[model samples]
Target: MKNFKPIWLMVCTLALACAPSSKDEQTAENEETSIFRHQPLVTHMYTADPSAHVFEGKIYIYPSHDIETGATSDDMGGHFDMKDYHVFSMDEPGAAVKDHGPVLKLEDIPWASRQLWAPDAAHKEGKYYLYFPAKDQDDIFRIGVAVADNPAGPFKAQPNPIKGSYSMDPAVFQDDDGSNYLYFGGIWGGQLQWFEDGELVAGRKGPTDGIPAPDQAALMPKVAKLTADMLEMAEKPKDALIVDEQGNPILSGDNQRRFFEGAWVHKYNEQYYLSYSTGDTHNIAYAIGDNPYGPFVHKGNVLLPVQGWTNHHSIVEFEGKWYLFYHDTELSGETHLRNIKMAELQYNPDGTIQTINPMK
Candidate 1:
């Protein structure tokens, strides 16, 4: 007779083979619910370049709404064809983040053509103002303003772009004395390199047709005081210089420390902290200054490179603790499709920020 296994033994073996292991179950759960550190704040949609703020005891995020447009990625960021903006909010750390939905869109702006990039928001005179950047009809990036009564807005855009604005990224810092300043500018596809001698020379390029030489002074982020109304720039935009410990300008070739884009300014212990992205190097570096309009001294990096080609962030203090809000390509696995994340930001006793590694 042929050897045969008992029915009960055969059933047990088959059941064990079909069941998932504990490790496999955990992995599947994490992918579906994203219950882990540095996980996306909202997994339902892609968001990037988060500009976080604390408004009325809640955390708010203004980020670029990323969508796949079929445009290939290029050095000029052709694939970052974002067209709208969204507002996200949370009651506290580890709380459910709420998506406030579409607050602004390219079609609503009278002058905007394409590529609605990063944005920021501010509250003044009991009104909420939304500051953003987009390419106008001429294909040149210019900053614009929109207004709404609520922090979560269906903001109405101004009929025209900010008169003296150019390039991309608009971050507003309101001082203790009630003065508001706007920080902006970026190179490459941001089109900052096209401006020469304070004028737009469309064909003009930087040193070596890309970045400045090692010894040359690095490009500076621009800053301007906002008018009392917060609708116009009080004066012409000026360079907010970033220099070394010895007060020398940081060199462009020092890609690790130089500014590429994403200018955010926050004040802690009466000292101004100017943090930004070192574009090609993919690091979030910072500088320290005494005043809002900075000749900031290079400090160090706040974050290492994330999973995507770009890194943009915001620093905000809530309920006596500070946090860093940023983005990466963790959700979609595509550079142009990103998601926002947050981590607790700690500062040393000497007022320097502790470097954070996203993977950890």
Candidate 2:
């Protein structure tokens, strides 16, 4: 009986040694799961070029999905090879964000060849339209529209590209009068073109097009009114943004007020706020104007200089608060494979935006 008791004691010791305590079990569980916050917004996937809007009392964020390449490339060049778009939503700012998954993919658009870049969305006549820019089979980038009934969509791409827009980063802005304007173009390699009577016409082409770089104001963002169907541009394109009140152009050589790409416009308190990622894609600054077609005076910075190589963003008001949705490279550790991040945007008494702190 004493010998049997020793064997039983040995068995008990082995069991106790193998089993973890409750606290240890809890710690292990936490280490296995990641807690996502509203600050970085969408953690599970890499998202960039956020186009946020309020739909049906909830904020929906449409961002370009940046897929990580397992192997390193020269200068981290191939990291920006994004092929899809994702829509993330939440009821409140600090609440848990829901990833609605890939709403649109590169394969869905037959005309689209590869590079699917920054996208924006708008709702009209009970149908939601997603504006996206991608390269065609000829390798030229053009803007296209996808349709869906819901905000979180399995969006159907329109058969053809938007007739006139020959650029990237398509942002759709709808006015209070139900009139919508489509803003599309990029800084370096994008074309500045317009639409008139549903036909595409060339506007101010960029330096890459063999057209010498224009002066500051001539280098501003482009805007065009959309036709009633919300697919094609209704009128000729206009240089509606980044000019001065006296109708003067800003210069690219002037580091302070230079225009780069990622043009995002939103009206706040009767002031037309045209915020954009300035030249070099590291900082975001904005200007204020009295009208949408702006001679927007350069207000100070929106997002202070960030660590990432390309800092693109959108400003939106949700639940009576304003937030700046942008991207950084904190998670990917490389400049190209960036992730979306957000900060609370503040405004001054005169309706100018306060400088946002750079993300660490």
Candidate 3:
């Protein structure tokens, strides 16, 4: 039998949803409460798949909310029963983060039903955009974008999901030139797929349908450019970043780098770092490339393995320091319930990232 723990935790990834919140409400909540005083991010509520971004001189975290499960599997609505998302922000280093409260909810998006999984955010042209993935009423997974004038927003939902997106873990990346890109896909047969310009670009067969794992590197990550408006894709998806020079994917069997899901793009010192969770779903790894569209070479692990069914993270620079934001089930007795955690990330003089020992 499969491990019940991982499945339980993954179940809450059933949908991705975000709703808009009023600025007055956001201010009221942040001023009234203190966060991260005890560390490990939010403790009062369960949050997972942390995607952190530095916006307008502040660090903001967009994470999935893990609600308690029901009496049984049937009662739980399905695994990953997430219905909404909250934005956490901090203005100063080593100070308590402020909870911006639920910025988006499932009910606000007319097209989607549930399964608010991992999400990412970006700022462009004075608008804050939330990129999320959720199951639509038709039972298909599609990516959606919600926009708000303020980072702490009562965001307005796009009438429909991104037309061609068909996977989970939607991430938005903005290059220094003001161009945007979306990275997504995850464990559907033990492999993840990629989308670009609202089209299917690259995909691989994996350990699905009781078949043996293929010799191909199953979990390779892919990327594509987004239009200036940050609402649509602008180019075709290309397979880059996680493969070897021969164009073969670097497998993890011989300790080679591999991709599972949760692809995050961060640029530092003019070099591109593509970080993601390994196929094991318990550890975070990364690769380096010269550009956003990469023939990225595998560097090494960014996060060691942890005690959870799934691991997700993002890299951000704040106050001249770099940090890796991720999650674990340490505080929760059950794997289905997870909370956000983070650790400082370091880079070698050669521009490679060092492995991180994430807090439980």
Question: Could you report the Cα RMSD, in angstroms, for every candidate shown?
Answer: 8.1, 10.2, 10.2
The TM-scores, one per candidate, come to 0.90, 0.82, 0.80
lDDT of 1 by residue, 70-104 (tens): 87777778889988899999999899999899999
- lDDT string for model 2 (1-360, tens) is 011223433455456557676867654543333222224676676778888999989989999988765635433133467888889998878778999988898988989987788899999988999999887886567899999999999899998998766768788878888889887766554543232333434553334442224442345677899999988998877775575546567665655666667888898888878888775646788888877777788877898766567878998888788988988765555566667877888888978888877632
lDDT minimum window of 10 residues, candidate 1: 1-10
Stretches of candidate 2 off by over 4 Å are 1-38, 69-79, 191-218, 245-247
Best by TM-score: 1
- Ordered from best to worst TM-score, the candidate numbers read 1, 2, 3
Go through the candidates in order and give the clash count of each.
Answer: 0, 4, 24
Backbone clash pairs for candidate 2 read 216-250, 216-251, 217-249, 217-250
Candidate 1: lDDT of 105? 90
User: TM-score for model 3?
Assistant: 0.80
How accurate locally is residue 296 in candidate 3, as Cα lDDT from 0 to 100?
A: 78
